[model samples]
Target: MTSDRITLLIVDDHPVVRDGLRGMFAAADGFEVLGEAADGVEAVRLTGELDPDVVLMDLRMPGGGGVAAIMELTRAGARAKVLVLTTYDTDSDTLPAIEAGATGYLLKDAPRDELFTAVRAAAEGRTVLSPAVASRLVSRVRAPGGAPGKEPLSAREREVLALVAKGTPNREIARELFISEATVKTHLTHLYAKLGVKDRAAAVATAYDRGILG
Candidate 1:
């Protein structure tokens, strides 16, 4: 937001990574490194305070993780676009972050130019993804049950999802349904796969969006 330069907030647990990103953005002409955070909690706090145009967030860190922070930020309607920057390109890492409301996903090994372009795209609220991540996502979409709200949920899965939509905790849901907590988790997982969502909130929202929860 400083005139034409894109403002950035670097979030990573490693000091070296943060330093490198700070230096990289600082040396670039069209970017300004607003601040750095060591974990997701700090990242959220600083995002509230600094109001950066884009956030370069890392996954899998102590204190807090990136997906949870993305969900929290999205829930709070943060202005900054979160562009996940991490070494993780696996489905478990990628889908959750995207579902949690990340604007883009990039591997840590991305080239300097690619990284800059991603940040710029994210700052403009465009979706960005590294080549590998994009390919994986495409493959996932081609897989069964990959489309959100398309696959029909089983009776038990529907029951679990309905309970989840009410914001009921897992234990309570299990008790109400006369099922074990593990069974509830299994049902949730199955429903999540069928719904093409990663967690409870997304499942409920997607179900409602698709008229499955109405």
Candidate 2:
């Protein structure tokens, strides 16, 4: 394991989930839980105060929710990276979170090792996704005429889209492609317009319908 410990902040409403993540990360080497929050507002406050390197943020909190907190933090100029941790993987949540500047995403049910890897990858600015979600994103890019005369996305776009469908964030995408975050946004914007969609899930569906992501 690497000698450097990645500082992590857990932000989930459920006490059990927070406890579980805290236990899991605590037992693992190279990870330190900087703090925990039970709601979005608290999450925002903690982010400003603690400045953890990575935040495991949940999407649907009672007061503000993950997207709200993320937007607030970003607007406030907090540089901490946000990694979505939620039970729901719908595009509604994924797209908004991505647009709001989350750096990565992971399912609640992911295996322990994969979760650890994802957290580490997020801290290092690499996108992580469950395999099933990746396939869906790939499909959206492959759909024909999805972009209406726009050239099909390059192999890298397809790769990036696959990860996007799985809810991976730009930081992770940049690391995965060995490129800059600005480049990833450029591709995503171009892909969004081509696919005639506004967000990650729509892009994935369009690609699948066109038979590109497959």
TM for every model, in the order presented, reads: 0.66, 0.67
List the candidate 1 regions with Cα displacement exceeding 4 Å.
139-214
Model 2 worst lDDT window (10 residues): 134-143
lDDT for each residue of candidate 1 in 80-188, tens digit (9 for 90 to 100):
9999999999989998998799988889998999899888878877667665665455433433544555668888888887776544678889899999999999998
Compute the lDDT of residue 70 as modeled in candidate 2: 89
Count of clashing residue pairs in every prediction: 0, 20
Q: What lDDT score goes with residue 16 in model 2?
A: 94
Q: Please report the candidate that would top TM-score against the real structure.
A: 2
Model 1 CA lDDT for position 151: 69
lDDT of 2: 0.78
Candidates in order have lDDT scores of 0.83, 0.78
Q: TM-score of model 1 relative to the true fold?
A: 0.66
Q: After aligning candidate 1 to the native by TM-score, how far in Å is the CA of 189 from where it should be? A: 33
lDDT of 2 by residue, 1-214 (tens): 2348988899998999999999999999989999999999999999888888889999998877999998998899876788888887777777677668776767788889888878876776555555444444443344465434456788888888887755577888899889999999999988887767766655765666667756
